[model samples]
Target: MEFSVSDLAVARGGLCVLEGVSFTLAPGAALILRGPNGIGKTTLLRTLAGLQPALAGRIGLPPEAMAYAAHADGLKATLTVTENLRFWAAIYGTGGVEAAITRMNLAALRDRMAANLSAGQKRRLGLARLLVSGRPVWMLDEPTVSLDAASVALFAEVVRGHLAAGGSALMATHIDLGLAEAQVLDLTPFRAKGQGQATARGFDEAFA
Candidate 1:
């Protein structure tokens, strides 16, 4: 499946931060979103994931086709690593938590509750969710946060496998995944004018 965004405008704190952004991800491809901090990367990913509305323009994919990973782990703190993967796998109807656990190197930590896991462990488990997501287009926000070098390499391999299997991804990250095939999209050109000027009364949320 192809994932695409065109002439997109997005807001954060009720103010437009990015506009006129456009890109397309073909099947088996990936795109990395890059810019200085506070450049609206989160807002843009949130908008693309339909967690927040886009201020304007178009995104070409159904909600079911995309799985989004936020900056946070989004884990069930009370659930064990295996349990967490099972929960998400059940939701996505993939029923393949074992593969995800092994893929993310969570097999050793599978029985540990999310709250007991270290930051990097939690991050690996979080990325593991995407394996069972069964969605072709991944919209990830800083997916490598909290990971050590080895874990990051593990993640890069997982992503590479996904693309090889004909999946696509859009990610916001500072770390280089050593993915030579992944293209970079700098959001600097799309920074909205008067972006920091938040209004006391702003336009209603826009979705598309």
Candidate 2:
């Protein structure tokens, strides 16, 4: 499968954040987004995931082909790890909870409650849902936030396995994910110019 973005523009709170962004990823490839904080990495990812509308351009992929993992873990604090996986599996109409658990190294913690797990473990559980999603494209935003060195390596292994199986990934992270062949997109140059300058137009007038 191939995923493409062309002349994309994203806005937050009705204010433009990024523009003129474009890229493409075929199966078995990965693209990493790099930029300083508030440069619209997360917004761009959200737009690509279809969580929000793009102000301009087109995305050449079916909405179902992409799965987004934002900064939030989205876990049910009251649910056990296994329960959480099963819940998402059923929602996505896919199964293989055992394989996902093993892939994410959550087998031992499968029965543990989400609220009781460490930050890294919880993040692992959150990422494990991606496998059950059965989507070809992964849109991740700072996916390694709470992971330690070992867990980071584990996550990389999981991503490698996905790519090997003909999946594509688009990730935004400040830390190195250890993917040697991944392409990088820096959003700094794409930031909307003169955004913070005082403009003659009011918010209501602009949106009107």
Candidate 3:
């Protein structure tokens, strides 16, 4: 699937957090959203995932074609790891979720309660939901948070594999993820503008 954000703006209580943000992603490509704290990175990802409404402009996404992984685990504390994944898989209409769970190295924790897991373990479980969802587009917010070096490497490999399989991704990360060909869009330029306004810079141009 392909996505394009044209002059998209997000507002909370009449305060614009993101303005005039625009970008496009074709199949098999990735766009990295980059900026310092509270510059609307999470808000923008939510807007793209349709969790938040855009105050103005257009966000073109295929209907039900995206999977969003936020910083929050979004897992039921009462459920076991396997149970949580099963619930998400059923919701997403995914068929082969067991394989995904195994690939994420959650087999040992499969029967463990989600709330009992460590922070990084919970994050991995949350990420495993993505592998099962099978959505074409992935919007991840701070995907590397709470991850160790090994887990981060695993995450990078998973993302690379996703790109190789012709899927698209929009990721907000503070650290380098070792993505060879990923494009970066800095949101700093858009943060200084007034409410209801927007600014955008292309990844190529910004990096240059």
Give the residue spans of candidate 1 off by over 4 A.
Answer: 199-208
TM-score of 2: 0.92
TM-score of 3: 0.89
Q: Write the per-residue lDDT of candidate 2 for residues 146-188, one digit (tens) a residue.
A: 9999889999999998999999999998778778769998898
lDDT of 3 by residue, 59-88 (tens): 888658899998787899999999999899
Backbone clashes for every candidate come to 0, 0, 2
Best by lDDT: 1
Model 2 ranges off by over 4 Å: 197-208
RMSD of each: 2.6, 3.5, 6.2
Worst 10 residues of 2 by lDDT: 199-208
Which candidate has the top score in TM-score?
1
2 versus 3: better TM-score goes to: 2
Residue 67's lDDT in candidate 1: 94
- Best-to-worst order by TM-score is 1, 2, 3
User: Residue 159 deviation, candidate 1, in Å?
Assistant: 0.3
Cα lDDT tens digits for candidate 1, 1-208 = 8777899988877788898999989999999999999888988888888887777899999999999999788799999999999999889988778988899998889899999999999999999999999999988898998999999999999999999999998999999999877999999999999767874447444421
Per-candidate TM-score against the hidden true structure: 0.94, 0.92, 0.89
